[model samples]
Target: MPVVLLRLQEATGSGEGGFTPFSINTGLIFWTIVVFLVLLGLLWRFGWPAILKSVEDRERRIQQQLEEAERARVEAQRLLEEHRRMAATAKAEAQELIAKAKAVAEKERAALLAKAREEYDELLKRARKDIQEEREKAILALRREAVDLSIAAASKLLEAQLDTETNRRLVTEYLATLEQQR
Candidate 1:
């Protein structure tokens, strides 16, 4: 152990002096080249393929997602257009409904006004007829009363002053005057 330790210390101390700059070193260079080749082959066989496949899968998935998003966007645009069309139709229909309502109301109003005017004219004509009939009946009643009063007055006058012969002559003469006047 002690000898080994002394040799390790001496070798460490003399390393700089024992070293050469370039020795051609065919064996070391060959081993280094073999290790680098093995590592490169391993990377190509496993690591590089896996990495590239993962990259491709990611690109494919992203493309699919972008396509889906585009489809969704188009669908949204279509829905927006449909909603606009429906709104336009509804607005037009509402306007037409309102116009129709106003027209119907005007028509009803005109019909009611015409009916009222007709009824008013009919009532006025009937009332005028009733007034004329009532006036004729009143005149006929007055005439009848005047005739009764004149008959009563003549009976009293003839009874007080005229004889039977004079009464008959007066009645005959009054009847003759009535016939001639008529």
Candidate 2:
């Protein structure tokens, strides 16, 4: 402002100058500087602090939100791990159950086979016993028939001369000789 005043004085001292076209106003410049300084001081004292506080609060809120998100991510990962472990355990248990079932089936099969073998052996034994009994009965019937036939033939040859006792003795002796030849 002082420099403007000095330039104005120099221009007025020049010879062909009426009120100069270009002139600086010192009072207006001084008053404009004063008003600008007053407004700057008011912003620094009040508005600056409010803006700073709002920015700090926003930053703190963002930090808290980030921490919460990290904790949630960790919890999700833990749950996934736990689920995998449980699935593996269940699979192992299912395999064990299958093995146990197979073992039981094998045991049952073996028991059934053993029982069938025992039944077969019993049936074979019964069949052999029945055959032996039938063979003995047939031999007895044949011997009786032979004896009767021999007695009748011998009586016919003797022509009623020989007695019963002598006929029987002769037949007995003939049977003994036949047995020795066989």
In candidate 1, position 114 carries an lDDT of: 99
Q: Compose the digit string of candidate 1's lDDT tens values, residues 69-171.
A: 9999999999999999999999999999999999999999999999999999999999999999999999999999999998899888867877678778998
lDDT of 2 at 137: 85
Mark the regions of model 2 whose C-alpha exceeds 4 Å error after superposition.
1-68, 143-159, 162-182
Best by TM-score: 1
Instruction: Give the TM-scores of the predictions, in the order they appear.
Output: 0.58, 0.45
Assess candidate 1 and give its lDDT.
0.88
Report the error of model 2 at residue 144, Å. 4.5
What are the per-model C-alpha RMSD values against the true structure? 11.5, 10.7
Per-residue lDDT, model 2, residue 133, is 82
Superposed model 1: Cα runs more than 4 Å off: 1-53, 161-182
Cα deviation of 132 in candidate 1 (Å)? 1.8
Candidate 2: deviation at residue 176, Å?
33
lDDT (10s digit) by residue, model 2, range 1-182: 87887687676756453444445557768999999999889988988889998999999989988998999999999998999999999999999999999999999999999999989998989889888888888888888888888888886877775677888899899999999999
